[model samples]
Target: MTSLPADDIASPTSTWDLVPATVLSTTETDGPDRPEPRPACEDVRPVIAGHRLIGACADGPRAAQLMFVSDAEGRLARAAEDGSVEPGCTLEELAGDLARSTGRQLHPENPGLRRVLLVRLDAPELPLLAALSGTGFTAVSRHGWSVVVFDGELDYWAVRTGLDETAVVLSSDGATRSFEVLLAGEDPADVTELDSADAVCVLEWGPPWQPAGGLPAGSGRTPAGQFEQDLVRLCAGGTSELQIESVASVFDLDPAETNRLRNYVGGGSTDLVLESVLQLVGLPVLAAKIAEGRREMADLEDARHYEPTAMGPALLRGMTTEPTGDGLMARYQRAVLRRPELLLALAGTEAALGLGLAGAARRGGSGARVLGTLSAALLADAAAESAYWATVRRARRGSARAVPAGLLRRFFGLPEG
Candidate 1:
């Protein structure tokens, strides 16, 4: 970590060292009368030292321009532009002229400027210049230009450089505060100060790879493996607070990857499972109804002199009624319990012959699918129970008639009249 004085940060200035030897004059044009000499467009040499130019443009008065240049592999790069250069000249010369014209000086203590202006020369530089505005040193555009303003005072030399999507943060003062610059838009003065600890944590999570020929696969530690191990260890037997914070720490993972990890841990087939069930099944509402019913039953059971004559029918009636516009699962359960005899009749039928109570209760699917299946099963069970009771009624009439064929037909899916 390194600390830079707040005043040390300044915008970049152009160095004219790389200006082409031959200058093209666009103002003067060849004509038949005067026979104006054809202007030579000399090839501009690349800036060799300070930074490499990634882009340029020539538009607007005096041909505004933008350029991108960088230093280290991951270190932020500087973006320089031709803010106010003399007309009709090479970018290199224009950069130098702008720096000299503005009378800006680089601090002796900060020697980050290497006196090379990366020129991305283009015609009509206004489009490029317009794009560069407000793009801080690390501001990168999809067009491949990165804008950087190194010093607030000498903003004239702020450059637009090309970049490779890499960012570097330099820190000092035990990492309490540092500067962050992007390689794509590297400007010496465009550094942003950040807390040291937080920056280090970010660096730790950056892409990791083995040094060339350093070790065989699995022979040495890897960041991904380490991260997974840490996650599992923290989640195992850890308090909710610890687990939550640990999860939050990795929030920077790409959204798609985060969802994949969450689905793996939440015991669901798909990422949509938990939310879907909560919304569709209404489990909380059903549980509340069950609680209420249990309380009601407890009161009735506590009365030792309870009479089935009056109370049983009333209880049965209460159970059979449709859910009164209440929550789905709760109403469903109440309706089923109202007709216990129906369940017993269905339990004797082939549908439930081999299924245990748990298996009989199991309902698959979600939302409408689950509701439809459960409703159908309940209807069949009730029909079976009604048929059984009807047979008993016929026997009590003393006629001992054959089971009502129509009842069997209706309940068993036989042909109907």
Candidate 2:
């Protein structure tokens, strides 16, 4: 019966931080030396985030669509649509598909990933061990949970989903309560039973875990004393909201109950954009975080170089070829914006590597063998960094936000002064 106060609630994350705002046309309009968005000699991995599914956001979705992923272990994200898992199906791909499933023309103002129904098993098993006393621990039954992600804002739905809340009980008298339980979803038996006052707020039997992500599989899960018996059913779903809830609850209460703790960490309001993006805060910490990412990447590369195993080469190839996740090429591309200076260093490094390989190429034996083998992949790492650097250099020379502007200039290209 009560609605959330209109002005008090804001979204938890903002896309504007990662997405670069479109800039006005620059010197490229007239100059003959206009640089290509990518390098001319495309031999290496390009230093840019190559989106796999472009215009996906530009395309609109139906009023709503449903995506069902399994929670089976080792094969956690099996797509239920065809009962088979796509070996390399990524989260972004899933999001994109769900966004386009209805196949409708999108409104120009509201294009891309409005909402999608995510159905999966829950993630409460791991943290449920803390229950002080409960008689039906072994009697819990499996229940499928579903939720819709609207514009990637997690907290908006958090208050309404009851299943995600946690409780502390002196006995069985207590239960974790959600801020509100507006609807209980559609069930025919209950339709005839509801009173006039109850009918206004009740729609369908809104399963407890929708906006909060799916619920954990209970007693009906794998039996005790078996190999898979001990495993807790997890719903680390593909959507941003599900992933955010699951990841944030690593050390605390049942992943379901971790909301209040998260709110505390976010200072009563958790917004990824406010904390990580906007220039209102000091970013010495942000700078360190970007540096840490670079360091971790360096460490992985070092491990691959010295591991002396056949797997190292395969791992390196995966890193370079995979465009998303922790891929090496992805890191290189992201570094282009976060640390453009690294692009200059990488250009020199690649230049030397090309020279070393040049002599090897002329040998025409082992050199040819290398080229015929993994040379394209090998050169891609170099090309990615070098090519991106070229654009940054061109922009700097043209006085594109080259002067003291804002802290963001350190991380992105700004407009002309």
TM-score of each: 0.14, 0.22
| Among all candidates shown, the one with the greatest lDDT | 1
Task: Give the alpha carbon lDDT tens digit for every residue of 1-417 in model 2.
Answer: 111122221212111011101111112224577542321112110111121110001000111111222121111122122222222234344334333642222121222112222222111121121121111111111121222222233422332242233310100001111111222332211333212223322111101112111212331222111111211111111123332343333223554345543443333212222223112212212222222122222333221111112432322222222122233323443355456788667656765676667667667985576753444444565675565465555554552211111112332333322
> Residue 185 lDDT in model 1?
49
Tens digits of lDDT, candidate 1, 266-298: 442232332232223122222111121222222
**lDDT computed for candidate 1:** 0.28
Clash count, candidate 2: 17
For model 2, the superposed segments whose C-alpha errors exceed 4 Å read: 1-339, 371-375, 378-380, 394-417
- RMSDs, each prediction? 30.2, 27.1
Provide the lowest-lDDT 10-residue window in model 2. Answer: 168-177
